[model samples]
Target: MSAAPPEEEEELALPRRPPPCHAVCSSRAFATLYSLVTYALVPAGVVALIEVRYAYLLLFVAQLLLAVGAVEWSWLAFRIRQRLLLAVSLHEDGPPQPQEPTEDAPDSSEHPPPPSSDVNQSEEQTEAAAARRAHALEDQPLRREDPRESYARLMAEAMRAKSFAIAPLADWLFCGQWYLAAFVLASLGAAASVALGYAVESSVFGSANPAAGWRMMVGASVEAAFVSIFCSSLAPSGADSVVLVVYQACVLVASMNAYLKLHVDVIASDSQVDPLFIILAGAIVIIVFRVVTSKVVMQSLLLVLCDVLGLVCIVSPLIAFADLIDQPMGHSFRNQFALFVLVVVATDVGDCLAKELQRHWPQVFQWCRHPLLKSEATTKDVEALAISLACGAIMIVVVRLGSGVSAFNAVEVIVLLCAMALGQWCRLWMAHVRQMAKVTTSAFYLSEGSRAGGVLDRMAVFLVAIIVYYPYIKQKYFSSS
Candidate 1:
């Protein structure tokens, strides 16, 4: 489904959250023949000789359709695996664990104990709802409903994602069929994405050189795979799951790139490989290990050495899109490579706390979240729990501003503010999951609205960052002749 404009997306009651900020032209996404109904076409008065597609456009369009199909096929394949595991799990472990909601349970929520007054109206309502849902859900156990019901519920909630469910590939991807063939199909889909990306940038866009094409291709492919893993659903699984996906894609790509760069240099003596590749690989590994390990992000040795590389993979696509409007956003893999190397690194990890070598930390590395969160915290005594996460988010923006002295982006600033506000709205969905506390059932609901918002937030920021404003590339490469 097409995404609505920003004004409509801001309204809470929209049917679907917006799509991800994938790095492709609007012509590729909308003006192509695959979606003929869009108003992007120029019509000649009935007796028209209009050039409908570019020479390679048809081929790209074909690949795009294939890409969509592959995505559904892959998701369905995993669903089969999930179904088997769920069935086996059910057989061996018996009915799913209950949330322990009973008539005797207190549906009414408790008073917020006085700890911090930063708790706002949003948190108050969210915690109250959490208590009520927890008690009420007890009446209807998860086992009573179908296990796959959660998956189906999410598919329905995400409007565009439903098309994949009904597609023929869904049935084919199910187990009890050619399991090996299904496996092969899964492998082929990933390969196709990487290959298509390389071909598009190198041949389709006609990059200045093959090296440039391959450079841009890495970020494009990683992002494509990343987006595919989550399916076309607006909702993402959770924070940890999301981080894992991004981390894996970035790590693997960065490693391959590091090797590739050195290999090219070895083959051509004059081909000077940037020393940054080595640093990029080192930094990404160390920082990923640090970020995923705990609640507080410990600054690794590599972060100091190669902080910009961590953001490069994700931001490459963002800046490339931004380069469309502003010239020389970076050196052309359509002009993102130079700035792709540039860093707007934020000091969100709080360096003052880091110098002490603080080993004791949290289970998750969030820039914004209170110190305490537990079972009782979801319902009662949330006064302390109601930390103004927005305040914490704002603190990070301040850090980012201080970090990026030049090239302030109004769009990014707006997105950062909107994200904190959006988090408050997501509290209801989050509270429900917290209340349920069923490991099996929580998977379905944890990603509810929060996941969609995360996806949309990233897309909006990522897309605007790229499609509108280009990162300032250093003058040496793109000096006006």
Candidate 2:
């Protein structure tokens, strides 16, 4: 039988395009619903706090819901934006080029060679080849699953492959990206806030034990300096140099302030140890260790240390609070120590989980190639929900058990957790914004080099410095004569 004419063959070769209307509508509807839910969280949280007697519990629930909504919305938005881009490309470029035939398809060599003939005959052979290419391309199945759905399926598979404990650590360590930086800032901020709060309270009450507040302030300032230095080292040309200088100044001023306020007879006394000296020694050890070990080994060691410290902190607080174990440390000391340990543990775990997710993302994407059912949820979603619920439960228990404890102390712990949560969300949201801008080519979105955004980035470091040293400022200048 004679092959069809070139025009008819070419027309037949093109794959049927799905109606854009249905996909666009569905995407927009989901985006709108997710956005509404995300926005509603703030009001819901506020209302929960105002109306509910146990507002913290309700607020926690609201935050958890908000987090889930944010993730879903982000994934959906990314997919929708991608689809739109594809549509635009198709419109501008005409039909997509035909794909090459698979190995399973009939070999071109199997057919008898066409005879060298007139130009018309050559054109007819070319049309036949194009028709076969189009048919092969059309035979390939289109992806129907949403990106979010795929992510969930992958997470579920990962969970099944690895135990809960190990999988989370790997996921966080690999997938976390910019989240680690945010967590560090948040933990530092929370710790600073707590220290500042205590100092303010001490000043107000005219307490003799100002040493605790002074020590906390000094430690926080030193930590700020270290962080600044670390950041400056990473991005030498970036704005971190200015931050490093500012933090160094803070450290110097804070140290001098601590010395002036806390008098000691050094000449008559025996050799005394300084906390700053201890901190420096530890820093030196860490630096040396990192230099000696491979990056992976160093990270593994750090993770292990954090896990050990976290477990110790979790148990220590319970033991001290219950009077099951005797700690020479004061009640305030124990409480603050527990708070610091908890913050460290939370941030470390988060960082590890993020890293692990990133590491295994290729496998996740591969696994997600298959279509997912609407009713299915990802392991990450379930795990996140579980964590939120567990945290809420623990907080409730703490609140109940510590009914006799001072309200100020309880509030301090709550504030610390809230700060960490806020910082995490802020980082995630910023990442989402950047990703959206990248995908959509939206000029309205902030660029990396935008001056306003840079200033805001620097502001985080600046705020930490100010908060850390505020206690010292109050003690030195704002004190009653």
Which of the numbered candidates is closest to the native, going by highest lDDT?
A: 2
Clash number by candidate, in order: 9, 22
**Candidate 2, 1-481: lDDT as tens digits:** 3445433365467453221122442354554553354335443443344333222122123223222222222222333333444445455766444333343555668644566666566777777877876776565433344545444333323222111111232246646332344345436654664566467554432435445445544454445444443333222112223322332333333333333233322112234334345334434443454345425553334433432332222222221121211111223233333333334334423433543554576355345434554533344433333343345335445644664444334555564455445434443444454454342211112222222222122112112322332333234333532
lDDT for predicted candidate 2 compared with the true structure: 0.36
**Candidate 2 ranges with C-alpha deviation above 4 Å:** 1-233, 236-243, 251-333, 347-389, 392-417, 433-481
For model 1, the superposed segments whose C-alpha errors exceed 4 Å read 1-183, 194-203, 207-210, 222-386, 390-394, 397-418, 430-481
Candidate 1's error at 249, in angstroms?
A: 16
TM-score of 1: 0.26
- Between which residue pairs do clashes occur in model 1? 101-138, 295-362, 295-364, 318-466, 321-466, 321-467, 322-466, 322-467, 332-335
- What's the CA error at residue 13 for candidate 2, in Å? 37
